[model samples]
Target: MENTYYRRIFNGCLFLVPALLLCTKNFSIGAILILLLTATWYLIKEKRNYTLDKIDWMVIIILSAYFIANIPIYLSDMETTRYFKGASRYLFIIPIYFFIRHIVTETTTPRKYLDWGIVVGAVGTIVIAIYQFYVKGMPRVDGYLYSINFGYLSCSLAFLALTLANSSHIKKILWLSFLLCCFATILTLTRGAIFAIPILIIFSVIFQSKQNKCKNIFKTILIMLVFFWGMYAYSAQFKERINFTVTEFHRILSGDVADAESSGGRIQLWYAATQSFIKSPLIGQTYAQREETIRQLYQEGKISDWPISVKRAHAHNQYFEMLASNGVLGIFAIIALIFTPLCFFLKHISKSTHALTGFVFVLGFSIFCLTEVPLEQNLISSFYGFVLAVLINFTRNDLDNIQDSET
Candidate 1:
């Protein structure tokens, strides 16, 4: 009876994880911490042996590799530890995953809470973004986090809402949440987030069509196209962002890197990071070494003045950042981190809605990583860890149920 009561409380608390994620850093962290502590208490009191499957072990190993790859650099230079600070969140995923599985039972539908949380998060993001952009007259709506993180996170939530809409009874509400999230993403004017729209639409169509007939697919696509077209036409910010991306690429291709803005700057950072990787491909360059390499490139005029003036440490690209900082091992770890879960979700996607959501989330992050180092930020990493844990737990439950029914 006591255990059941505690479980109910734990399940209720799960809603806060996604609900508060976009609104405040501390509340989300606090919610996760509460769940973690409660789960730990139960684990200690019950003294039950929990088994981790192959995929679980693989997740642990991949997350560990991220931290271990940075150890060599830390040993060589202590000051470089800060660069890998966010890597600690990867390690926390191990405990988070275990505890979620421990508390979320077969009888309890945890996804209900999580789905509610996603809707709340979508609403919260839209409200915050609207206030920031319209009332404050800010060029970009960042919300609680910076513009890029806010945008990509909103995009992720949008995808999740769309996925839930597939099987949800309240399809209209979920669809509305999806639109709200898309609007928030547009408000931020994040090119990477905007780039994810077609991917989301593609995945939505693919998954939704599997459950329905072929004829409905074209109708779905048409509706989405019209909605996004309306968004693009109505939002001056979105159109300007698309135009700026095009102009930046044009300038870069025309051999005027210095004149280009974000795209050109990223290219310069990528070049410097590549050079650093070449020098120390095994473990990659230390933070200081990477910075020095960038400085030298700036001096030689190989890198643009704008990037040099900003003086960012890590590569703007996640892959390049890992290649430059942690070398081959770091890069491999990150790839494994993304692809391992990705493959699992892909395998079970047809059987499980959670798997579909997980697949979309992982794929979306993979896209976001192209232009930004998302895991480098603590808040973003923590959010990723918690959401991934929830999805994985529910996905495993779904797979197990399917297997049981098959037998």
Candidate 2:
């Protein structure tokens, strides 16, 4: 009875993770602390040995790689808090995965909690977005965080809800949640998050088509097309953002860099980042060093003056950010961080909804990283660690069951 009661408490905490991740500040940290405490209690009281399997070890290694890559910055005399704090979130995945694996049982599955959390999280995003955009008249619906983070996080939640929709009994609710979350993403006017919409739709159709007939697949595509068309036709902000991107790209191609907008700014940042990488290709430069380089480039007229004036810390693109800040080692660490779990999730995507959720998340996050250094934000890093830990735990359980049966 005690074991059952403790398991229920653990599962309840899991349910609150995604549910409050976006809606409330620091809720995920509190929930993680609760889970950790419970896990520690189990460790001392039961005196049981919980060993990590190969899959768990892979997750730990990849997550740790990002943090390890940042060690040099800490060793140097620089303002390390901004760089180190976000990277430290990766370490949380280790304990989270361990405790979740140790606590979960056949009778008490984690998937349902996660699925419901996604649903609740999606609803919360829609409400917050609507209120911010419609009621408060904000330019972008940032939810509890800033615009870019909230936008991409909403995109990730949308994909999770969609992936689980096929298996869920509350299919309509889940689908509605997915569309609303997409709506929320659109309201943020984040080009990266909006760009992921069609990609996610295609993947959803490709992976989930086996469950439905060809006609249903076609119907789903048609519905999505109409929905997007409606968004384009009706939402002035969405249409303007799309058109502005095209206009900016054209200006860049025409060598009108001074008048170009966000896209052109990104090109300038990328060039600066490339130069920084060339200067310190091995271990990379500190944040202060990188900024000094940018200042020097601005004076030399090699790059524009905007990045300097704004005092932008990152290169806007995550790849460029890592390349400039952490160099070649950071590149390798980030690639492993993205693709290691991605390969694992892809292998099991067809069989497990949990794996599908994991796959969608990594893919969507990769898209976001193209335009923003999302992991630089502490909240986003924490969200990534917590969500990936839960998904990996459930997916690994499925893999283990398959291996056990084969043996």
Candidate 3:
């Protein structure tokens, strides 16, 4: 009876995890609440003697390395509080990962509910985005969050729905959900997010092909390409954006430092970040020192245009940010964070649906992170951490066995 009660509460909290991610305001609150609840349940029910698994150790190693990278910040003249807070953002996902792993083995019903919750949240966001577009005449449909975040969330939903659509049961509803998510992502007008869709399609085709369904997956990819291209061709703003990007690319090659366009600015920032990394290649610099480093480079005429009037917080690219802030260790941590789960997913993809979903998400988010600092912010990081933990837990051997036996 006691076990049953704990199980009920655990399942209820798990259902709310993904739904809370859709809300901009309640995200952190929900994350804290869920983490506390999970921790409490584990201590009270398990008598405080839980052992760490290999994946758990991997996460610990990453977190430890991240903390070590931040140690130099305190020695510098910067405020250690900010760096400490930033380093601790990933802590919320650890307990939740253990809790979900425990519950998932007992039953698969929660997976169904979790999928439905994600779909409902996606629909809610889409409706709000449409309303914002039509009623307010907004330039970009940002949904409940910023335009970039909305694009990332929409991309996540689209891929999740695609995985569901590939399943034999309930294909019709999931296909509609996938189409809705794709439409929502398009409305975001975020070129980085838009670019990730094709990569996702290609990855999906490759994964399915390994399962000996290459012809079907290839046809689906072609259809998606046509629809996406049609959307681009029909939307005047999207076309203009693409043309602007191309023009900016040429300006970059011409050494036109005066081009303040997004693409050109990104190129400049990448160059600045690479310069910073070159100076402090091992441990890099603190946030304060990194700023000063960029400013110093500009003063030395190393960077063509420093935009002295504006303050630059990060390198715009996550890889560059890690190399600048955390140095080589940070780079290794980021790589492990990405590809460790990838190795597991690829190992189990031939047998488990959960593995396929994990692969799609990790691959898509990794590609998304290349150009944008999506994983650096609190809200998006929490979202990624929570979902990633759950998926990693899903990849456990027992659950895979359960899924295999049931199938």
Candidate 4:
């Protein structure tokens, strides 16, 4: 009876994940429920019987290391929620991984609601973004989420939908969805996402070429290009963003950092972060301290004209943020956090059809992290955690035969 009840809750969590993603606060609550139920199920039934393999251990070690690295801050300054929230991110992978794995292994229907759930969420958001763009006349439409996160979600979903377009009947709806997502992404005007999606699409085609045949992938690429061209030609906001990017580059060249707020601000933050890291490279500062440090640098004129308002912001780059705030340990933990799943998914890419789905996810996150700290935000971070858990669990050998042939 307990087993049956846990299974039902597990399936419900899978469906709730995507639905809850439409709102950040609800998603947080939903994620907590998932963790609690997963813990209850594991403790009651699977604790002694379940065994983790090497990959699982590696993932857990990375997460634990990250958690430990943040302990110093939490111990020293228990006042702020920064340490708790930062540390909580590392906790997500375990319950999420185990819960999804249980559903896949013990249940007859695996990820039945998951794939469609993601699409349902994406389709609804895309429609809302469209309305915001045309009817609301918002230049950059973010839908229910922040603008940059909307861009990140759109970029990932566009690639995910591209992969799902492998089937004939589902292909048309997915392709249309993919196009709409691209439109929504362009409207976000997030330069990193705008740049990354094209590259992701090209690389995805190359990655799938062996299985998809060069001709079909090329045709799909061409169709995507035509869509991109249409958007580029028609979207005034897109053109203005591109023009602004060019202007920012020119300002950067002229050493007018203030005028290059869009791009140059990141460069200034990187400089400040690097200087701060040199002071304590082994075990970096806490989040609050880091903010204060940057604020001091800005005051000292060391950081030069970077606004004080955003000084409390972590380094815009994830790698830089990890190094600046968490030091060497955090860097190693993040490397493991990113690459372990990447290596696992890449290793199984050719063998499993769902492998690319997982690959594109990490790839999208990595690309986004290059410029923006996507992981720091609760919505994007939780979104990544939920998606990664589902996709990585899908990569298990138990579901190999059930893989999508399109991937």
Report how far residue 162 has shifted in candidate 2, in Å. 0.6
Give me the displacement of residue 299 in model 1, in angstroms.
3.2
lDDT of 1 by residue, 1-407 (tens): 88677667667667787788787755877877777677667777878776878868876875677788888877777764676777887787677677667767655756677778888888888889889999999999988788999998899888888987867766788889988998888889898988888877787678767566566667767887887788779878777877788899899899998788788888888898899889999988877787888888888978765665555466788888888888888777787768777888899999898889889998999999999999778877877777777788888888788888899
Estimate, for each residue in 97-164, the C-alpha lDDT of model 2 and write its tens digit: 77777777544665677678778888888889999999999989887788999999899888888988
Give me the runs in candidate 3 sitting further than 4 Å from their true place.
27-32, 62-68, 74-80, 84-86, 167-169, 209-214, 257-260, 306-312, 397-407
Task: Let me know the TM-score candidate 2 reaches against the reference structure.
Answer: 0.93
Clash pairs detected, candidate 2: none
- Tell me each candidate's TM-score: 0.93, 0.93, 0.89, 0.86
lDDT of each: 0.80, 0.80, 0.69, 0.69
RMSD of candidate 3 to the truth, in angstroms, is 3.0
Global CA lDDT of candidate 3, please?
Answer: 0.69
Q: On a 0 to 100 scale, what is the lDDT of residue 373 in model 3? A: 75
TM-score, candidate 4, is 0.86
User: For candidate 3, lDDT tens digit of each residue in 1-407?
Assistant: 76566567656655565555554465634745666576656766787566787777876664445556666645563655555454565665666666666655634535665666566766766786677766887878886678887888778877877775665365676667767777778788888888898888778777766555777677877887788678668888777777887888788789885574676666667776777678788777776666777677678876645434335446777777777776786777677667777777778887767688888988888887777777766667766676777666766754657777899
